[model samples]
Target: MTDLARDGTHPGAPPPGVTMSAPDVDTHCPYCALQCGMTLRATPQRVEVRSRQFPTNRGGLCQKGWTAAELLDHPDRLTTPLVRDPHTAQLRPATWDEALDRVARTITGLQTAYGPDSIAVFGGGGLTNEKAYALGKFARVTLRTRNIDYNGRFCMSSAAAAGNRAFGIDRGLPFPLADLAGADTLLLVGANVAETMPPLVRYLVEQKARGGNLIVIDPRVTATARQATLHLQPMPGTDLAVANALLHIAVTEGWVDKDYVETRTAGFDAVRRSVAGYWPAQVERLSGVPVADLETAARALGTAGTAIILTARGAEQHAKGVDTVTAFINLALALGLPGRPGSGYGCLTGQGNGQGGREHGQKADQLPGYRRIDDPAARAHVAGVWGVHPDDLPGPGLSAYELLDSIGSPTGPRALLVFGSNPVVSAPRAGRIQRRLGDLDLLVVADFVLSETAAMADVVLPTAQWAEEDGTMTNLEGRVLRRRALRPPPAGVRTDLSVIAELARRLVGDGMAGNGTTGGRTTGSATDGSGTTGGGAGSSFPEDPRLVFDELRRASAGGIADYAGVTWDRIDAEDGVFWPCPAEDRPGTPRLFAETFPTPDGRARFLPVEHRPAAEEVCPEYPLYLTTGRVLAQYQSGAQTRRIGPLRTAAPNAFLELHPDLASRLGVADGDEVTVHSRRGEMRAPARLSDTIRADTVFAPFHWGGAARANSLTNDALDPTSKMPEFKVCAVRVERA
Candidate 1:
């Protein structure tokens, strides 16, 4: 955290006419994985934010970062807790005490009536690392329920799975973002960073100015694609085929780095055989991309001195997403990109803390430090840190979408607690998810604003905003950055860490018997009792994020994404620190895989993958493909961005983006209402005719709710490996509404 001045003055000086009572707090943006650095200063009337020098943004601020301060005091901010009156069955404002009591009582009653697994906890990727760690501990230590997971499962699971499969690790970006500026060739598959992260465009601009080849593969000529030297528009869900074709071309053209492949990688022969069948012409016929374009893209990547390949949500939200990403990794390996100084394959994580959020225990199958829940050694190490027996911890749970789908099932959780996420607006098959939430015996949601999910909660707890709390967030580059609070939270608003701690203490004190002990050792090393407690809960659940983080460092000491060497003071002093820092005296690793991979054999693996059709393919009944993504003005689900005046004004509602030819064929003009139908459900939005999109594909922003909810038309087919739902590609039909 940034230090505050004792005297009444700003960091350097107060603005010309404004007098400050304290120093401005230097912090990172509350949205996106870039985590742009900024300084928050207080004036007499309003708070102001200015860009700060940072590794990712380089002192550049996107529109979202410039206008983020407006959301601090939003009119719709939830100031106090709300509890549903059982008789009236309507939400009514209640004191924090009453709300907490009701929540604990309900959780206890539900567990006693059903089973310990009847209660579940749902977390979010936007949560700080400390909060995420604490919530995961609360579920395992207090509730002893295996039904815990977070929203990041929807964002980065497929990429993480593929990265781990091929490299024995997944850190989002193995290299820093600044490396993009120096690349000789950069290939972006299904990533539209231009709109989602405008500040990052400067690096692309730098690469272009240097005469580097910039290639983009997508179904639409998006803002980012328009900037590329070559754009290969493939049909949705065919990214794997495109990657395999590029590899096939590289092999046919004799562009493979045979020496590097022989020394630094394994299983290349299998991958080479797999790509042998994906001939350029055959792939051109399978996907919509042409043969010439495929050959051109392959040559650029193959011949470049330093090349990078990246995948994003567009390529990783299908039932075949893991295979698609693995295909890309196979190509990168064949090109000898991994473990190079400045070139590699990477994933563009979407949420603010998606990389860090998954590193901690909030993930369904993971423990802190990215440890597998089913691993005995990992369970023993984490349990020792929590002062519990390894046998006391529960096993793995369902993935995000599967957990939501099982909400009303006979064997699934009957009660749920949500923190920092509004799943109703974000989950695939959202309409059915909404009905599932309604079917839950208890639904508790925590947020600063009344989001679509919180609006229907049986209990709503107000949480502190980003600038009103102090914690840490790990950016896409695996750099740990501090989030400093400029001011205290509102009188009734609390932090999620505090809420989880208090709830765990309450459950422990009341002896939710079927579970393990919680209260005594909630904080790291608060008690000396090493093994599992017999029957009583401790009262030592700490609410301080710093204490929780201290515990996290110890829990993650020897694990994969180790944070033992990182400290708050070090982060502030060094700007930010990268992890797997095992000791405080050693500098953290900024660039990974320079010498060797982390696998047992010390070599990157080449996983042979084959392309498959999307789970829901377009047929005669639904003859068009539907895809969803973010808009420039709205962040994911628009839980916070929707409430900001400027952001909402820029993108007020969802729109149906289709090719001009498709609009003309449907007899619909721009601004005319159109209905999109799929096997799951339908959504209505205004037509946004443009020649940028392919004639066979339609696009929609997934940031809106109500009749314009795009996720309603998405498929819920899960990827067998990653458990990621098919949110990007689905079969649909369009009509004038």
Candidate 2:
């Protein structure tokens, strides 16, 4: 790493675009969880994004982050609400009053006909923490529906499930991401940081500069793989076997940290018995990693003074995702990795607010402050803040996939309100989910663009983007960073907070339960949750984000992912406030599990897990494995990134990446048209021959839609615990189109 990489500038170099001295607002990127620091300037022509000093990226920006300003005034950006005409059945421009009133009337009608559960809410990981918090409250208090969940369920639910059972808590990294800079060894199970997060590569380089080893394990030779000291190309859906085998070798080689296991962890004996059969030769035969490479990887990780293990979607998007993550955590534990400074297991969260999104009421099973909804104590505490009885709050709802699958069924909601997500392009078995969404009695989508999902919505409400809003977002490190609005939203666009508040007002302002009231603060009354009348909050639905945060702080005062002390002023003074800060005077916790574990016994647990075949395995009919991932130039579902000119030009179309041997066997040449068929559906794209992938597998980016939609062929088999659909690997066969 050079001094320039550290300082983000040279002696006399010019800044990103506009002068930093004239920066109108300082905030983070609008893309991934890196939340790279940036300064927005009001250039003569448009809003300019210039690199600014911050910890996550050190002022470095990827192409997607650099070109983000283009979306501020994109020609396709929606500036008015669109409502489906009752007679023509076509979306047409409408006033905000008409659109919101129609949605509110539909909501009342559906609930009156089918009950409160007739309405469901879907959120996204891209929303600010304030939005996430308010959305959850809206679903529970105003709508009184038990069916609320978010897209983060697809991103890190597996890792989160594993983390909770083992460590008794789940914070994406549990430590600052910068800690990787001083690590002796880094084992990236399935993450490709070089492309997904370019700025994070600097930490890997620094570790290598210190004579440390960087090991990468994946089916394809990704750009991150090219930078590794050693690359272990395992079979698709077999990384768990590799992890178990490595731990087996560590035990045989006497590399186990017996002292740490004896005192800091539990259930070692069960794990020891579980992994006894995962010998080197067996794993080599099962995973195709070869015994020698496994041995070397085991040695590098086990012998290191301080080593870390990380997992991503490739390893956590399977039916056995939680168990697979547990396998790696088991290895990290056996090596005495976690709870010791830079050496531990962490998940590299994908979305911009993935870490915080799951914490505050967006997920099906959680409430504000990362408290479980089913827990009576948690329910009572949060209900108090909202001025409602604990019994009045709805119970846990269905997870993301199940909610979508049940869309029009007898057990599912008849109406769905979507916020900041595009499941029609991102969901597994998307072709089917698309039809389910179509069956809804009323479908409302809030976004800045007409995404594939929004295109099918009965009502589309244009909402504000990141640069046009002031709120907070928690990055991968659990640090709560402030997002200052560079400018107000365009003329016809409004913030999601405003939309939610207005709808709540329409539903409850007349002292009518959204489902029709019996009067006297019974149903969705005019009261704010507590028995207060018109004075305290003015309206139960407060549109200002700051007011919502004040409520969030009070509600989360004693909860696990505590944000009681994390004020906006505090966030501005410090780089950002880490969570578990219970009071204004107490410093936030940057590194969890540094002293005592948060479990009942004050120790981490060793949960034993085994390798299992993918939900859909290859067969004679479907002889090849298919995996999905993100491309460097495009983000998830390409809702925003694909709209940008430069990004669209960089990755203009989706392509089927196949090994030369496979392409030759199938009689397909580079740029030739090819179609891939799976049990769910099929997708077609131009053939892209690349020896970087395994001969038995094919790859495609899931950022495009229509015939190129890779998700159309993905399996929907879900993890039992997390309900996460297996989006990574499925059985498929290919032929020239």
Candidate 3:
């Protein structure tokens, strides 16, 4: 197949540049994982975005991507450092010198009093690969602390955990998105790509045009589901049963790929027995999907020449998320989908860099290149690149929620450094997390905007925005593309790398020598005995993106997501490059496990999983299941997207979406005020009545904070294997306000 056909870029003629003289800089959008390619024409006044043909989103731009430039000149953008007054409890402008010195002193004092682990670092998946790497390195080497994790643990941790257990690696999408176009059938579970990533719906449209069938399993008839050939609306948190029942039908009808299963997989007997109990009738009773529809969906998958199974947060943000994904995988294995062209299972990553964030040491239990932190060999390899002894490196620390939960505890970290995430509006039980932030001795937030989380920080550092920075971001398809700086950042703002380096110098002294060595001590020769670069006690960390990427390459040499062969120059020349490119001249592996699986015996494992009830079940008191998701106009947390005038106008605030029956029962109208109360907290929003959702379920977007924060009612119950909170399903009572 041609590259254009295989990569899923433009299927027609390319468009001309908006400005031919200046040659607009080609870059990807700063929104979802599709990272839709776009060209920016920069002028003294503003930047204009135009679609650029690329693999993921082709030449289309979503509403968020089209309005992303508004954030560059947002009125509330943080242009200088701010330090909160101890007595007044109000943040006031402060000089960089004053803010840095005070933050350093507070962190040092905290470490001295409560030990190294007392200082924690929290990062975000929106950060570039280089920033994520630098943040992890700064946490482990400079602070010498084990308390470090990123927001990705809340995004797709369950999918990652399940993928690793089943495939020996997790790269979001093993095959290119283009492969979906050739599949005979597609079974999408809990993903509303038509609304979340609008450009991707073209593939589904194409599939339908070609007479291919589409099966969508979700609690709500989402926009994406409206286009499906068969939409199976299951009860919330019953996805595992739907998947198990499908496999049961396939096995009972003698539609299994017996030869492929025996030759390419192991542990099938256990899975077969596990799924035998989930017959169509039983699944229909538990999942609320009719037996006729379940049979039709199963037959479509079982008989298709090639099919694809894709899932997203809806099926993964539950107490049994790993098992839910595992059940889906078991169905794919039974049908011999994986390792086949135009077929296999993949997770649709939500965040822009969610696929790369966890692969590069930002996760609590991981190192760069998807290596486990507890593995001795992995530690030695990463430590050697960082110029530190393996023994000096800290072991696995707390996961994202665990770290957040420990913020104000007696034995918790006394200080926290947050970069790029607004957890105040995004975290499960957000109201509690906000209160926890209030109790911290020191909270430092580095972001371009004064987000809800930054507003509560003791010190807020102004950082460079996406268009003003040069780095690389890995999209959902495992393709790493370069993001070039089109213009200079605001005068007072600094890049995240610069902020991280400055903090490292102040906290660890001469260890700022970008070589990654700490020298096992914290002392320097500058003011307050802390060294400055250029003329002080030690060398400075390289602020250049290329230099930092060189170190990242070295650190990831032998790991699963190896990028040693990929470089900025190569990315610029080739549009993008896929990972596991271990050698300079070697072509990247586009579709993995074509010949053999990555497991020990070169065979895929069929994990046995069973359906489980939601962690927080609906009862008489709170007799409705509440699920949370995103809206088309707003992105995560609404930190940046809300600042855009048109987007804000499009989606002003959060609302409760319920079936007409439920709305009638509650005596609420479309625009009537309603109060939703859960065990943890209550939130109020306008009720939006619809028949697309199950009568026993309600829906809300989790993008807004304050009284509209959906996460305030989300459960923090952890998935045993993934540690992912149950953000998709919770119990709540709705009343007219």
Candidate 4:
């Protein structure tokens, strides 16, 4: 493990106005996807944070990063493990042994009575790389259950699935973050990084500095749009129309890159002919973007020296999300941006560990190193890495929503273990998911705080937060960095790794016994001690985190990641390095796609596109459209950031965004509480009038929950390919309270 700060204290520790010495600690922001590199200072009592050198943020940080210390010892922080008495809803402080034993007994009881499939594990993208890796292994090897998934199903699973299908691999940026600094044009669809990851806005700012044009397409004009050169307000669920229009212009006007198309793409003719009917006027009628603006956007994209098209959940969180992303990728291919410098298709991942979680196969249908669970070769590879025979591995598992819906059903998984996720506040169809959780036989939740999800658990395991843990985290651009602990873990709290180990020991027993999955286990499972189940009778297993990374390096043997030469020694001496580090002498790859595609034929696929209406459409009774997104101060579901002082002060509560005309018609004022309803459920929050929203549209932050959860009204209908919910836009009605 890396050493603690020389001064012996946590970073961001000073009082609101006090000055302190910088602790010789370097780390990344523990909050959002921007992953701004920071220098943390610590004294005996407090920690202070300042911006440091990093490619993504480049010596810049948002308010959340600056106030990291507020959460270290917050009032609501859970300092001890707790267990709820089944008879009464009271939570009593319990020892770690009691909590772990309770979880073990409950899980064992469920498995014994209902079968191994009855138990499930749910992880989160907010977890550190180490924690995520451990959690995934713990589920598959110790629990021996295929019903493992995470909240990423609600975030970027759609984008990841689309990218893998089109590009043959799933790298969010196949390029570096700095590449955007030189682009002459940028087309952003459904992203509001300005409010979510403020440090990243600098790249757009730099683009504007060089006369680069900004084209923003969204149903609502967001904070990022205020700086845009052009904003194309589209109708809900109609982004495919605008995307097809751009492709049509590129094909008809002869702007298509014939060389790249012929050399590196398949299914071009089909896509070309498909877009012929999507003319500007037709697209304008379908989307709300005017014909003139569509033409201008197409021209700007086609004619710019270098154009980058970036997309996020807003475009990917729909029933037709996969098709929409495929269409956008086709447009990028037609514009010849994927393989060139200063131009490419990039996705800004929403969570701090979203990219890494996917890379390590924390999803329902994937394996480590982004290998498919069903593919023979991928299964062989992961099984070999996991020390299990390919045939011994289970088949593809259900997505998060499906898993939640399946609970307590005859065909459903009945037990669940959650780590660092609050689905009651974050998942779509919150009411249904909560009821489903109630139907489960057993529920164990591990988190730093008593999150909404944990509130329903039969046993709650208190775990360390970012400041109280030591691990690595991968940012949006796939940059891996170390997250060192500055403070000791709370009195009765434990690291997720320790808790997972304790549970694994309880389930699998001592290394002396042989289990087919874990080989001859010394501690964890056989799969190289990284908690993977091997082919042999479960043998030797290592419980240490560093050894786990060693096995991960071994598993990525011939691939882009080789960590044989890397050690905590080297990491501490030289700071953190990017992955795909083939050798000790060579530096890690910062950008991908410089040479060739990773596909079998070395060509990218131009997946066909078709538009589908949202699962729920606005009716006369509910005539206004509702969109969900992040607010400036709150992170996903507000588990930790909500406790941060400065951020909480800035946005203490959730408020609905409405157009003045709509608000006036509804007889609602700025502070008036209004109930927003859909077929699924409803929530009441104060309404704020803003001209930025369309007259018939309203907006709300997805972070609000509990009695006022946003997901209660969100449609849980998922994209057919990715199984991601439509959290972006849906039909809803608003009324004055």
**Highest lDDT among the candidates is held by which one?**
2
Q: What is each predicted model's overall lDDT from 0 to 1?
A: 0.87, 0.88, 0.85, 0.76
User: Between prediction 2 and prediction 4, which has the larger lDDT?
Assistant: 2
Cα shift from native, residue 694, model 1 (Å): 0.3
Candidate 2: stretches off by over 4 Å: 1-21, 510-514, 518-538
Better of 1 and 4 by lDDT: 1
Tens-digit lDDT string for candidate 4 (1-737)? 00111122222232255354455677778887767777767667667676676667776666677777677777887878888876876778888788877777766666666666788889888787666666665665566677889988888888888888888766677777888878888999998877777777778878899899998988777778877899999887889888999889878777888998888888898998888888888888777789888888888899899999999888998888888988999999877889788899988898888877766656777766565678897666656666556665666789999998899799788778898789888888899999999887778898877788888888888878777677767677766667777777878778887887777776665321112234222232336434555433222234456656665555555443334345555566655556666556777666766667777888888966866677888899878788888887788998787777666777888889999999988999999999999888998899989998889789888777865688888888888889988887778999988
**Per-candidate TM-score against the hidden true structure:** 0.95, 0.96, 0.94, 0.93
Model 2 TM-score is 0.96
lDDT of 3 by residue, 1-737 (tens): 01212122232322222232244888888999999988888777778777777887777766677777778988898899999998998999998989988888887777767878888899999999998988887777777788999899999999998988888889888999999888899999999987788788878888988899999988988878888999999999999999999999999998889998999999999999988999899888898999999999999999999999999999999989999998998899899998899999999999999988888888899889888999999987776566566676789999999999998888898889999899999999989988888888999999988899999999999999989999999999899988878787998899999988787777657332222344333222212111211112112356888888877887788789999899998898887889989977998888987988878888888999988799999999999999999887789999998888867876888999999988888889899999999998989999999899999999999999889889999999999999999999999999999
Runs in model 3 deviating more than 4 A are 1-23, 510-540
Which 10 consecutive positions of candidate 4 have the poorest summed lDDT?
Answer: 1-10
What overall lDDT, based on C-alpha atoms, would model 3 receive against the true structure? 0.85
In the predicted model 3, the residue pairs found to clash are none
- Candidate 1 TM-score versus the reference: 0.95
- Predicted structure 2: lDDT: 0.88
lDDT of 1 by residue, 81-121 (tens): 99999999989999989999999988888888887789888
